[model samples]
Target: MATITAVVNLDLPGPTISRHVYGHFAEHLGRCIYGGFWVGEDSDVPNVRGIRRDVVDALRALGIPNLRWPGGCFADDYHWEDGIGPRDQRPRMVNSHWGDVVEDNSFGTHEFMDLCELLGADAYISGNIGSGSVREMSDWIEYLTRADDSPMATLRRANGRDEPWKVPFWGLGNEAWGCGGNLRVEQFASLARQYATYTRDHADNRVYRIAAGAHEDDYHWTETLMRSFDPLDRDDRPATPFQAVSLHYYTRTGSWAEKGKATEFSTDEWYLALSRASWMEELVARHSTVMDRYDPAKKVGLVVDEWGTWWDVEPGTNPGFLYQQNTLRDALVASVHLDAFHRHADRVVMANIAQTVNVLQAMILTDPESGALVLTPTYHVFEMNRGHHDAAALDVHLKGAPEKEVDGRTLGLVSASASTRGDSALVSLSNLDADTAHTVTLDLRGRDVVGHRARVLTAPELAAHNTASAPETVAPRDHDDVRLRDGRLEIDLPAHSYVTLELTLSPTPSQPLVPR
Candidate 1:
């Protein structure tokens, strides 16, 4: 068997992996809100106060730390006031951004906050800046978070919700460089500063405002935004314009017009998909360098608020729904992107996958008419790697690089990231090669292995996915190809698989002066 060796140093610690890094994004596109997650109380969709119960329970099980709502360009067009009063009296408008579908102001602020509360997840509210006024944005914040007897707060109370919701994260705008407003970097920066200036704090909830940021490799946008905040510490600048700036990148294989379907793809497309997924590493590294140049202190974070594979909408579905099947390739993509996020946790404080349900690389797929929900392969990967949240990332070194060749380009075969919390350590490993199984020898240096368990997500075919008929077509299974003996862990990793190994480490010896 082809072998790859790795040594994980328990003593060498990297940055603390933030739980918020495993965040999710929920847009108001297609069925993501209406039929996917929020099937009204009157519907027979097994809902908890209008929110889908199965979706809520599934996301809750994954320990979702935060969820960004009503976005992906939808936030820019949304007017918050129209969605607050009685449902029957609410105004309806066309969602010109996605399929031009009619958006009945049914699922608004209250419904979103309720869903977040139900899932025990933090709400990252993306404010409307493109078509919304400063007063409108300010009043929206006041309505949700303000606890005082202000006019907006009073209106919120009269709407039926007496208590204020704790909205911790706020996006001043989203994608201002494009659909957000088509504004230049400086224009977006100035408008963001002005809009963020009036957004007041309520009670103890101090919102973390995120300025709309760059598209892929747009270094100038990052630089300009950073320069805009250069005088933040000075007496003249506004009150710290933003706590974070976002970067949006998607792993879109092939052309936009010819974007391939989610499941029906050749092995060539699979290899190309893996290659595109690996680009995230370079993006994060280059973006971090630019961010460091401007903010040496690393006070501001780099939030990847929008990401994931954007394939063509599923066949026969609404072209704007962006519904795509999740396969083992997507699972591997999640592993790759998540591992990159963990490595750059020092600066990449938070990231929200493009969407959470019925969208690009969604975690759960729901058949609204049938009330059937199926967890995707990407969901299992997230569930398996939950231990990495809030843990300290550790350094791991590989002895030799395992590689695979697809077409003319060579791609690395493995991605491994380790993290420790208290006495337990978790390691996530992915073999990117589609046809090579690797037996890996992991040297658990300076740690006594007490217990070990493995879970793997893979399938016989690269394009295997769970359809409504066969929901378990590509699900996780208990893996026994791993063994821990005398501090060394041996894993027989399968091709095109993502595995998570949980290890219970014993305390290190108090006195140690020997160098191996």
Candidate 2:
């Protein structure tokens, strides 16, 4: 096995990796909301107020910090009022965006809030801007956050929710350049300002309004949105029209018209998928540079609200549902993207993997026929890296790391990122090589390590996945091929694997230590 060297600068701590960076997304598309998270109050599956219990419990275990809801493309066409009041009395409409199915409005504002509560996650609601008016959006915010005897507040109470829900993260729209209405960047920016103006903060709930931003490397779109921020107010401070902007990206091996399969892929495609996911680092850096010119203080965050692997729908499934099987390849994609997020934690404040359950790169897949819930390989990555949430990012420098060429692009065979919290630190690593095991050595600096533990997630093949009957097919297992010797940490990382190391660090000494 080839050996690689890396350095973990324990003293050089960076920005706090926001817990929100490990966020999740649940769109109305596919079975993500209906059967995945919401199985109704009468279903045989154990649930709490119609929300799936198994799903919530599994996600809570990962410490999911926030959840973006309502839609991907479906948000723009969704009318909030239609989902309120009595479930049966609520208006039913055709969900034009996904599968052209009828939406009964059963899982609406209250239901979403309840789900968030159960998982102990913050609500990141995407508003309807494509077909709804400013008044409608304003009233919805009022109804959700208002505390006093206001008009919208009164209406909310009448609907059975006596107290308003706290909505911290509010989205202006989703993908305005496409499914969210084909408006120019300038037009969308203007609309964002107008709509955000009325999204008031009520009671103790302060909403962080996020405007729909660019798609992929649309630097111009981000520039336009940043330029549209309201000029300095009377106090000579920038007006808070929106706290952050959003960007959506997905790892697809082929064009939109022909996304590759979720399973049954060749080795070339595996490297291709990883190479594409690695591009997130470039995207974050480029976008952050643009934002730096406008907001030098970095007060504004870049929320990657929609991101993950998007493959062709499973066979016999509705194409619009976006249901795809998750594999070890998907887990590595998540690891690489998360490592990028950690490296750029200063700017990339929040990132939500698309369709958290039963849709594109889902954490859990529920069988509709058997009512069985299976945790995907990608889910293991999230659970393993939960320690990085709200932790100080540690700089990790690699040397002699292996690399491979894929489709005319260089693909790094090893990926690593580290973060320190309290007296413990987490180091997550991924081995992209399919057939080669690597021995990795880390030169730990600035702190004394008291102990260590490690785990590995990998399978014999890249296409290995979890199913209802065999949920542990691609799960994590305790790794014993790791040890801390002298000051260096050595780890034996197997091929097609994701590993995390938990290090117990001693407190900083008041004086410098002499050479032992």
Candidate 3:
């Protein structure tokens, strides 16, 4: 490992990290919608719309604030009407892209919005533009969100729900630059305008209409959306239809074709995974620059709905199913991503990581055969860092580095962020070096931290993970190893580990840190 800079400035103002940023996705592809979160209504597992009640309860326990349903690729072909009323009567469509499996429109509009209610989450719908049209998109929005007592509202009431869902977030399409349809911005922009025109405002609802946004680091696509928005309309009365511009990014350790699925990978592989995750900064900076040019008021929020590492799945699992193993490395990547989100909290209002349960760095995985469920390492990171959601972000200045060197590549260590909640202050720090642990000094200059103590979660190897038999392998522990002498707090970070320090200003000592 080479010596590098780990400088952090905790003085910049950042927006509140949306609780929705901890949101999840569920696509109809693979087991994500089937055996994963769904179990047939009477399989001795209990379900709603073939969705497991246990899964719903667990996600609610994790405080999942918002959920995106339908598809990444699957959303393009989904028809809302087919999924209502009777299950057996629903039409079966072919899932051409995913195992050529037949889709039994059993789980559709009403089912998804109902699940949102069960999970107590805000609903984010991805409209189909590639295969769906202005009318279909318009009607679906009307069916779910409109309360004007229209035909769609009557249809919804007949289907069992009397009130509209009032879903806050709605996407124009999914991956327009790729799976949704390889449409140029000029083409997508016109299509977006058409759809927004029909999917207009309804009652008791102020939908945050999200335009199908750019992929990673694609500045020009954001440019087109902003330019096409044309703040000044034909009547010069501000006519941009979109409330939020979106971005979709997925990280890969290596090209998917080069390597097959495996639980254990090389340090190089681990580094590659992390390096891809680190691009959150670049994606935001470049995209934000375009928004600055056209939408200078920062009125439209940035939404990154589909994200997370897309690694190979476990053996014998459907590759299209995307059932991959989760590890400590994934957890760390999650922590860093959350930190990045906190840093860029101003522009980025909401995001969801690809598919939730049983797919792509999932928070939880279930066993259909054994009726078992387990929380992945990625799950724990969200639990630990969830405190930052809706909290003000503070910038911290650091003077050191956790430099990493692998096969001619070098990167720094020591990433940090500070946030204050009410009277308590907290700092999240990560040692980004894979081989070298560093002693970090946190200068709490702005606020007066008198008799407070430090709490830490760390490990020496830094790549440690948890298994079913050994679930405590990567759990956080109290670091008595921390020292807070002279108001200048110092702590030791293990190689490539993450730690959260809560600074309390109580005159009395709280209990010793509990490592639960």
Candidate 4:
């Protein structure tokens, strides 16, 4: 029996948490594209323009802000021209990065943009720099975004599309230190400057170019990028033609060859996953410190374009697909990382979990063999905490909270962050203990909260997940564990649970809510 106390001040506002922080990444690996998102219009699986209707509907419900397509090492090797024109005429290529499977080029640029349009999300295109030429990259940009009658635009129109799509976010390259290009930081910076310079803005589409950033605690990489780009600034303006830098880190328990299983972990591994995921706070803090040295005004945003737990592939699944199950552990991981992002909203403008479906820590998993799709625990976390989007983060402090010892390490018993939207304040809390439920006393800084609603995502087992056989076994349910009396809120936070509390403050006089 443990009790934790926290205080939140709604008046103290931080940066508006970017909705793009909830963005999703979809790569060209495994069933992530072919079997997960697209099922062909002729198939028995209900589909919209060849994509699974259930998948599209689920993502739309999540209010997906943006989607990054065609890479995680595949983008650098992909040639956009081969994916255009007629489907039969398109050439099939070997995806050297993932499983060595042949990519039919059936779902290419057109399909990705179409999917984004359907989801009502912005498109973040990761371009090829490892094996693509400057002319090719520039032409691809023109073909998708150019409004004028250029050769690439004309070719695009001749293919089928009458109007160009709006692609606001562009990745100069992905993982240049490894898959994108095996080059030194200086060489990569040189290429980023050149390639990003040619990524033009057509019509109303202003491109926000993001430089390829460090993998983990690569402080030198961030320092080198900021230094190289520093010389490109003139009159407090960027001359390098870029607006942001990207960061990627994945949570893993063991070595790549011996990574632990996803849904078969013990309490120790569960704590380890959450503790490692919490490292995003340190990563963002240190990286933003480096970015501040060069761009103190915070003009250059830090985009965590790829992040999530990565585990060994499920049994009998293709190893290259990076497919794994999502459980309550993953929901906690999402909570910690999201809370960190909210706490660091000043510098962390956006973050995309890797990825959206049928991939590492995916939101939705689709069974191509059976036409079944189940939303994972990670999906419920996103759906429950969607209120933080576009809301001003409020100041929150936790005290009298102790740490739990697990497997030679200690982690906080609880983590919390708050945000204010109009007349309501949203508070998200995570209880990391595996056995003990904590009664949390929330001090609202004298704000009059007339009403409240809450939802909790938890299960009796730590490894509990939603399978095709039992899709609703692990989902969010209306929580009634909160009580308010004498202007103080008390919450019974179940162990290993993620809770979201929406407090309605300052209700109108004509329609006052009854206090409970």
Estimate the TM-score for candidate 3. 0.91
The digit string of per-residue lDDT tens for model 3 on 325-360 reads: 777777777777777777777788888987788888
Q: Which stretches of candidate 4 lie over 4 Å from their true place?
A: 231-239, 405-410, 507-516
lDDT of 1 by residue, 131-188 (tens): 9999999999999988879999999999999989999999988899888999999899
**Cα lDDT of model 4 by residue, 189-279, tens digit:** 8899899888888778889999889999999999888887755435755455688889999888888797889999888888888888878
Extract clashing residue pairs from model 4.
none
Deviation from native of the Cα of residue 441 in model 1, angstroms: 1.0
State the lDDT at 211 in candidate 1: 91
- For all candidates, the clash counts are 0, 0, 12, 0
Q: What's the lDDT for residue 35 in model 4?
A: 88
> Which residue pairs clash within candidate 2?
none
Q: Which stretches of candidate 3 lie over 4 Å from their true place?
A: 1-13, 46-50, 232-239, 259-262, 405-410, 450-464, 505-516
Q: How close is candidate 2 to the true structure, as a TM-score?
A: 0.97
| lDDT of the structure predicted as candidate 2 | 0.91
Per-residue lDDT of candidate 2, residues 302-379 (tens digit): 999999999999999999889999999999999999999999999998999997989898999999999999999999
